[model samples]
Target: MIATYSGDTMGTSWSLQAVAARLSVVRGVQAALDRIVAQMSQWERESDLSRFNRAAPGAWHAIPNEFADVVDAALMIRRASDGAFDPCLGALTERWGFGARGSVDRVPQHADNGGDNRQIDFDPQNRRIRRSVDAFLDLSGIAKGYGVDLAAEWLLANGVRHFLLEVGGELRAEGIRPDGQPWWVDTEVPPSSSLAPWRMALHDSSAATSGNYRRGFTVDGRRYSHSFDPRTGQPIVNGVSSVTVLHRSCMIADGWATALTVLGPQAAISLADAQKLAVCVIVGDREYISRPWRDMLG
Candidate 1:
């Protein structure tokens, strides 16, 4: 028989559906997720990421293996996405009221890539890093997806091969259902929209969506997106509403989702096409699908 477990972590909810679930399943998975949170959560004052954030400039600080791995992935995506998927925006994160402080009183300025890009250097061999300037390294964009992957690893290593794992709406699946069907999930939809539902099958794959509507505050009738452009030091105002990415790794999916959302429609789609990424970008009342996405569906 299949069993299900659910709980909260990293400011979001997580759930797992596995075969022959034991009492240890929840504990095991929770432990795995806690590992990531303790290493990467900027919310935790003593997390490895938090410590690194406060590290004196030019002084390299050692990071845990997992934390280093995620930073490596983030930096790769940052380069691939032309710095659209940055991790050194913790300062902007707080400025826009989405950081460890929870909220702030500041009006967001217009978009311009002229702001400081915050220079952070990673030493992969030593599993350490240093920064040239003081900036918060926020993994909020991608850590949740890594959390989901951690949960999946727990389930797979514990001999539960067939399962579906979800954290904060990002998801990963492996093997097959007891009935041998793929785990099906729907992409996020805006509130009060009558758009037709889009579903995807997760069979050893993952999906992550980034949307402007997910978080932000409205001021004087103007709405802001939680997804900020690290290059601009402000929440992106591009007309793109949301972007969903499918990949084998949940972390990559999460990072690409944010990057594509920041790139807006035309440019995002162009980059997705160049990267051969399976992406769906929603802008205004229209949907833009990449070639890879169509291939994935078929």
Candidate 2:
């Protein structure tokens, strides 16, 4: 029998399913997830990430291994996406009222643009980070995906081979179910459409979807997406509704999804082609799938 456990976390929810039916294992998994939230949550003032955000400029702050790993992934993606996906948009996120400070009625005159990846330095040897500039770091786009990966690793370490783990909308699946069926997941259809949901069978891989439909606000009849473009210090005005990425690591998939969403359909497709990444981008009424992603679907 497949055992399941789920609870609220990271301002959202997390779910885990494993082949072994053990309450002890489930409890261990929950504890592990809780630790991740305590370390990485932007909503939590005492989180490791929060402390790093508030750290003095040019001062190196020692971070937990997991936190460092997530940062490393974010930095790599920031370069790969050509700065399209940035973790340094914390100040911008707050200025736009998307941060822990809450939303505002209108956009601010001067959005604080401090958190560019170039301003931050990581010393992997010591698992510490320092910022050259006074910038706030926000890992919302990629932290949850890393959380999912952590949970998956915990399960594997506990000898649970067949499992599906999800933190927020980011997820990873492996092996087969108890009944020998492949693990399946459904993609969210655009809210404006009445079409059936898209489904995919996952096996030893991770998938993450990033979209502006569910997380945004309208101001004076103008809608602003939570996905911000670091260069403009403003929410993206792209036509793409959502972008999903499939990769060996959920962290990479999650970061890529956010980066590709900011890039829109045309540019995203080009980057996907160049990087040979498996991607599916939803632009208005149409869906664009990369050749690598289409093969994954088949």
Candidate 3:
């Protein structure tokens, strides 16, 4: 049987019927996820993408298609949202004391609409991106969701027909669990008012939530979100607390959730309607709202 824990850091469970093979598969999947994380992590100064961050302007280097693909997805979301979400907002994030080493209680001016991410440009076709200023690429917004998708792929390839894979808070499920129920999750925030969680039966889909509660800092006696607005180059200060997105692909759901959260309730609702993206938003007061498509849940 798979060793299960009530409060494991991963917050997940797996049945032990196919115990031996499942462990092997999970290990392989974990290894693969680690590799992808290393390659994409902005924190690792030695990572390939990190090297690009340090390169001089106009320099082009041959990058792996895998890396290209991940950044390409990020860039697509950046463009698709008209700059509502940005991966190139690393410069401001650090200056605001959200980076490797940050000075607590000091709110930098660039934390608002005066950051350096405006100079970064991504070119999808050439697999080359440029930054006129020094900056970092923070994948905190979408990495876990991408990892979930990767894990699901690994499980499916192993002939596992029924499973739920979650890394961080991004999750994907297929078929039914050992109890013969579609694997599900709750979309409620923890009692702390500091953590918003999600619940859903992910039989053939992926779900992800983005929130401002866990990753915020007090600045000038007010709280500011880590989510940056690409269009204005500032952190989102809206009242909407969290957003959960569901879609066929975990990556899309993950990216869109963050984007929609930054957009807040009204704008997110409008975008959900326009793009037909299935979404749910929980305002600061605990009232949950969702796209009309979520009416299918009834």
10 residues in a row with least lDDT, candidate 3: 2-11
Per TM-score, what order, best first? 1, 2, 3
Score candidate 2 by TM-score against the native.
Answer: 0.94
TM-score per model over all chains: 0.95, 0.94, 0.85
Query: Alpha-carbon error at 212 in model 3, in Å?
Result: 0.6
Per-prediction backbone clash count: 0, 1, 6
> What value of lDDT does candidate 2 attain over all alpha carbons?
0.83
What tens-digit string does per-residue lDDT give for candidate 3 at 1-298?
2222111122233222222244466575666566665667666677776787678765556566666666778878877887777777666677766665554686665434444434556567777666665445766677667766776777678886676666666777777767667776776463446544545676789877886676778867888777767666666877767787888888888888888878878888888878788787777556455555567567
Instruction: Put down candidate 1 lDDT per residue, 221-285, tens digits, no spaces.
Output: 88777888777677788877778899999999998998888888989889999999999988776
Q: What lDDT does each candidate get?
A: 0.84, 0.83, 0.67
Candidate 3 runs further than 4 Å off: 1-21, 110-126, 190-199, 286-288
RMSD of 1: 1.8
Global local distance difference test of model 3: 0.67
- Tell me which residue pairs clash in candidate 1: none
Compose the digit string of candidate 2's lDDT tens values, residues 204-296. Answer: 999999977878888789988888887677788888888888898998899999999988898998899888889989877888888898777
Name the lDDT value of residue 224 in candidate 3: 78
Q: Alpha-carbon error at 176 in model 2, in Å?
A: 0.4
Native-referenced Cα lDDT, model 1: 0.84
Order candidates by lDDT, high to low: 1, 2, 3
